[model samples]
Target chain A: MTHFEPISPLSVLDPRDRGGPVQPLLTIQGLKKYFHSAGNSWFGAQSVVRAVDDISFVIHKGETLGVVGESGCGKSTTARLLMHLIKPDQGEIIFDGEKVGIDIPLTEFRRQVQMVFQDSYASLNPRLTIEDTISFGPRIHGMYESKARLISHDLLARVGLDPSRFAGRYPHELSGGQRQRINIARALAFNPRLLILDEAVSALDKSVEAQVLNLLQDLKEDFGLTYLFISHDLNVVRYMVDRVMVMYLGSIAEIGDGETVFSTPVHPYTKALLASMPSMDPDQPTREAPLSGDPPNPINPPSGCRFHPRCIMAEAACSQKRPALETTRHKKSMAACLLQNRDTPIPFPPIKVSGQ
Target chain B: MTPNQALETQPVIARSPGYWHGVIKRFSRNHVAMGALIVILGLILMAVFAAYIAPADPIKGSMLRRLKPIGTPGFPLGADELGRDMLSRLIYGARLSLLMGLSPVPIAFVIGSLLGITAGYVGGLTNSLIMRTIDVFYAFPSVLLAVALSGALGAGLTNALISITLVFIPPITRVAESVTTQVRGLDYIDAARASGASSYTIIRVHILGNVLGPIFVYATGLVSVSMILASGLSFLGLGVRPPDPEWGLMLNTLRTAIYTQPLVAALPGAMIFLTSIAFNIVADGLRGAMDVKS
Candidate 1:
């Protein structure tokens, strides 16, 4: 197996290199994933589901990048691609300074970067106990039984579930939130630099969600880890991530520093997402919430912009021009929208930089 | 090497007592299975100690005492047409009956499970090829297939064992492949892959444990069918040549005695029925215990 630089360039912590365009630890260049949808009947036809349609982004070292989108918007697909769980058809992912596909085996990449799934209960092997679940990767990767067990106990405690009480228990014995905590400990077992949470805490109650979020923050700081946090809850993303990327049907709609994107969303879909958050105001009207119609079948997306059909502020140009992500004035983040780049009837300021 | 990979390697912890204990507890709860298990175990011991258990030499016959009634002097279950001790022969028959019934199950289970798990995991072309081959075998009625195989192979103990083993492989493979396919798509399997476990390790540790339970229960159900088939082959004179104390062969030899000693003629058939029933009940109990839904 060829060696790529570790997913996190630990050497990049030099004091002299403090302030420049943050050299992203992981760079995903125009990744695309398409699934061939099989026909239902004997004589049926087949078509492609463009799951991750030529999307690209960077994950800065030690920063949590949140991915927010509707149910089928491909946020999880992007996470899967980054982890090498699924191969991307049309792009490359470069980690640290080395390109992943060129030198690294998928297994090697997995050691540096790991994932925690959405359904915590489903994610764990029911046949294995908390200790084995946490120690499985380390054992497979060649950790000693005693050492892995010791580390597992420490991690279990770190994740806020007492190791003595929980380590011997099986997955089914635990509550959803407890199982998710165990999931976090197991993901951490391999000492990955980047951890992808694909709606990890989404299955828990609100109270449980906050506690897990807090635990995650502590673990991140303690280990100096980077994260790809995917969720549908805009509020959770705002609280947990340093920057946020909002997707609309297999493409990025808007992305920026989390606070700025949440405050002033450049793309109409992002704006709609922010408005849709359940509000304290008793009189907040239905029209304010943007998501209504089911996502158009990905096998045959709309003419140009995939989100055009559901985009409330969409104009004739929106359906004709396939907007590419462009640099906004803030410079760190980008968005893809006709309104972001030209003078139109829309209230948002006209763009000087065109979305390619 | 990665740091985690560089660490001292160790084997996974052994399965805990609770795991097997739980399965045993669940199995024990099924009263019919428990009863069947006891009867089968007892029969197995009888087969193991057939020499000590049988009162007389099984094949030795006295022309002087032919067709004697049950509870006749010095013969607990009396004598058959050749005056062979019915009780001794039936006791001796347990060994052959069980050898035919029990032996083929494990052989089929191992072969069928390997084929099934392989086809299921590899999928697409491999799956279709193996499963279709099994389907062709399945197209023949199992009894006809066993009889044909035994006849073609030239009947005897080894031929009968081979026939019964071959007859079971197709359906067991079909069940194994389907269950394995279902398990391969489960989230935990994907999680294992993402954790960098090799394909072999994943299949062994993750997939095999889950699939084994269902495959075993199905294989257990095959035992009864195999025993009956073996006896059928012997009754047809294709298995155990005459003078062997096999249940079916004994039945074939005692056919003329039915009118004079009706109960004696029925003994071998009763043994076949009871053995098969014992297997069927145990299999049913195992199915209930292994079921994930319960």
Candidate 2:
């Protein structure tokens, strides 16, 4: 077993010395993850699903960055990749100006970054009691068992579960909401600087979701934590995030501050996504589908802009080349679309949609 | 509502039952298993106290009393071909019989689980290498494999035990491998990995508990099969040698007297059948009790 020097207090308190406070807490550069699926025919080539295709993003300190996409759009894959739960095939992840697995060892990097899974029930070991599960990470990271136990109890209480009532209980003995609280408590046990929550509140009912969301909000403030929140629920994303990144077919279509992106989405895919949110006003029910067809098969995603087939404003030129993410009209936002890029010539005049 | 408020709203805080307590509670409810357990316990006790319980010396024999019918004076359950008391022989037989039948399983369980779990958790090339090699063992029928291995190793109790243990390992390994592969894909494993748990720690702390229950139930079911196989080896003159009072060996020695005193001749065979059935149903009961879904 290799020995790692314990992280010093100075380093933990002031980790971004090289880049100072301006450096993003975490940066993902050209992260790609492809999965091979066996082709149906006997001699056919194995197809690769580009689950997360050369995506890049930054999580600034103390901000909740929500990643919104339809099912199969690779949001969960990105979250897993960021946590290093699944190794990215081609990319670098920089944490606090130090390259993970290079300047800092993977174990040390993981200690600073933790993840909460979407399936609260499946995320917990049924055999371990709540306290055991919560304390397991700290104990493995070299904390004494007694100290770990104390921390586990403190975290359980902080997460709103009475330590005495919940600590000895198994996962099956708790409600879904209670189990999710346990998962959150376990993630906080490391006192991680960054938390990648993959649809953390999506599985709960509305009331429970609000409670967990509030708990998450409070914890983030208390811990000075940065969050990479991934979910398909647009309304929830709007409520929980300061910044939002909309994805389509394994690639980002738009990203910006929550207010601008929700009100004035620059990318056609993001426009349709925002328009598709189930209207709270019963008088303004959605009369038309947002975009047509399922997401293209990731094994062979559509050429050029992946969303061209479904984009309401797509042109013949849109299928010829992929659009790079560039600054949009809103200085804080960026959108990846041929029409949004100033250098690209629009092949045809824009057709105005009625509502816009 | 806050958790404390929710707790106050609830009727009561019932204590959650521990896993083992639940297993025992469920197992105790099974009438068939309970009966089988009693029978097995009786057999084990008989084996343990054979010396004090057997009325006559098992090995001592006389030609004059040979082939006496069951219930004959001073020789209850009749005498064997060499005039050995059948009841005394069967009581003494339980010791070696139970020993031979039960010892191979735990040894196989440990070795098989280690190999299988390694192959399953560390997948890809390592999985291919270990699993493909184990699959080769499946090419030979277990009965034939046991016979051939013991035959090659030459006749002895140790040789027979070794062959039976080898025969049991492949199936147990296959079960362990499949279960571990399933467990390795679960979210808890991913959560553990994300928490920076070493592979060894993940396997031990997360995967083992989930996989062990099914593997143990499967291993328990194999015990009866092992007993029958051990008995078969003894009957074929490959296990316990003569005058050792093993049920199978006793049956083999009493074969000629079957036509004359058929009831007495069948006593050892009856013991083997009864003991094996008891083991089998008890295993079934355990499987039912341990099933989390049930």
Candidate 3:
């Protein structure tokens, strides 16, 4: 495997290398959200779109976990579910050692976890000024208006926008990148522990995207934040995330440290995804499509392994037997592929039931 | 990062006006809307100062001078079937006419926004319940429904207003609901929800401004329809009593003189047509001005 120097300097002191066992900041288990297709009559069983089906993953403390997938692969759905923007069909989300909605009330859980969405303008309340938008969370949580304003101005400056100039402006008055900076500032209003960035920088121009990514990196370290970064940009994922999770049809195909997953993908689906990244080098040109055909209709995904139909390494068994996430040869990663050869057979840990 | 730092040092651009300020500025630039607004405001001022503005008493009329032609010496607009000065009565009629035209709208706007926004923001069962109930009100034509409601309630200003208010609520509610639904799905609302904002707070701070503008514009369009409906009710004898100088009632009492003095007889109808048109064009202007994109 060709080793690429880690883009982020913080990767040198891996969270896994801490003295004790690495802590899981957020644990999701068996998360499912099925949307009922429109035009279904009220009487009978409706056609269900299984947006996120039985997905489980862990976001370790102070680490950025990038989730990548094609459109409708349920990356966005998973982000929404984690934030409880849309309630999951069946699942448990444990945040910072507390059961969300039970041990920690939803309101309290929300204060510790905030989200910055993909649409910079749509994600902001257009009617509110930048100051109002940033202070909105603090005011909602009962902080005095004056104090909230002060904190918002401070945050506005920290996000690299001059508070004096931008704080009074409305969303429409600002550019896409500036609006995103305001969104980031607002997310930090609660001093949130985890930030769910759902394609947060995808809409910006390439130059602005780099600046915003750097700002996010600085803010993540400064706030000691764990990020659930959802993006389809492989180059960005490699640069911004410490760990990478590859999703296909609402299931995790492979997950490992960014360098390992990018350089040596075990799952055929993950390999296809990495190869799909557009090459900048003139000497090495992509000769063929990495994966053929669009993802199967999510309404009735293929039985057993969701990726079996398109997976190049699929076997007869792959079509019949579902593959659970299992440890791969590399100690730092796991792959959910029937053909992945296992020697030590370190079984993947089962998700703990809610109460336990 | 370097570019962003440069952006920070750049002086602030000229401050953009607030949303409503922009709306008002756009509204002022529309000549047709401004003209309509002036006409409506003039009529309102005439109504407010009716006692001073009217040339002669609207109630006392001589039988000998009844059904006089337009441009009569004493009565500039002529005399109605009751020989009442047409201009004086029309001037005085503005009070009740504008009241009937304007009052029902705000009442319906408030009530409909509450119902529609509630049904929209709290979706599923609550949405189905409220919207389905509103659909029941839409089964009958608005005119027939208003007349029937006025007939059932007994004819009076209050009852007529109530009936007109009822006729407008369903359309306004439907508009409010759809707009609220649209705004509710916006990412900002989701962001607010994720920020631990209570549903009430989301509806108020985040959802209200977005949805209310469209709903208000829709309700303004309803005002013209309300005016015509109220006039129809009065013409049907289910609104203002005979002696009142309301435009609709005046039209009813003057129907007998249509053949003898058609010009005089058409004056009240003319007033109704003009006022409704004024209201409609102003509403169109508001819609244009408030088109968030512009």
- The DockQ scores of all candidates, in the order shown, are 0.30, 0.42, 0.55
Which candidate, 1 or 3, would have the higher lDDT against the true structure? 3
In candidate 3, the residue pairs with backbone N, CA or C atoms under 3 Å apart (3 or more residues apart, or in different chains) clash, namely none
Which residue ranges in model 3 land beyond 4 Å of their true spot? A1-21, A342-356, B1-16
Q: What's the DockQ of model 3?
A: 0.55
lDDT tens per residue, model 1, B1-294: 785453324234323345656778899988889999999999999989999988899999999999999999898898999898999999999999899988999999999999999999999789989999999998899989989999999978999899989999998899999999988887788878888898899998888888898899888888888889888899898888878889988888888888999999999999998989998998888888765446
Instruction: Kindly list the per-residue Cα lDDT of model 2 for residues A198-258, writing each as its tens digit.
Output: 9999999999999999999988877767889999998889899999999887888888898
lDDT of each: 0.83, 0.86, 0.86
**How many clashes does the backbone of model 1 have?**
0
Going through the candidates in order, what fraction of the true interface contacts does each contain?
0.42, 0.62, 0.62
Task: For each candidate, give its TM-score against the true structure.
Answer: 0.89, 0.91, 0.92
Which 10-residue window of candidate 1 chain B scores lowest in summed lDDT?
B6-15
Deviation of model 2 at B63, angstroms: 3.5
iRMSD values, candidates in order: 6.9, 3.6, 3.0
Which pairs clash inside model 2? Answer: none
Higher-scoring candidate on DockQ, 1 or 2: 2
- Taking all chains together, the TM-score of candidate 3 against the true structure is 0.92
List, in order, the clash count of every candidate structure. 0, 0, 0
Best-performing candidate as measured by TM-score:
3
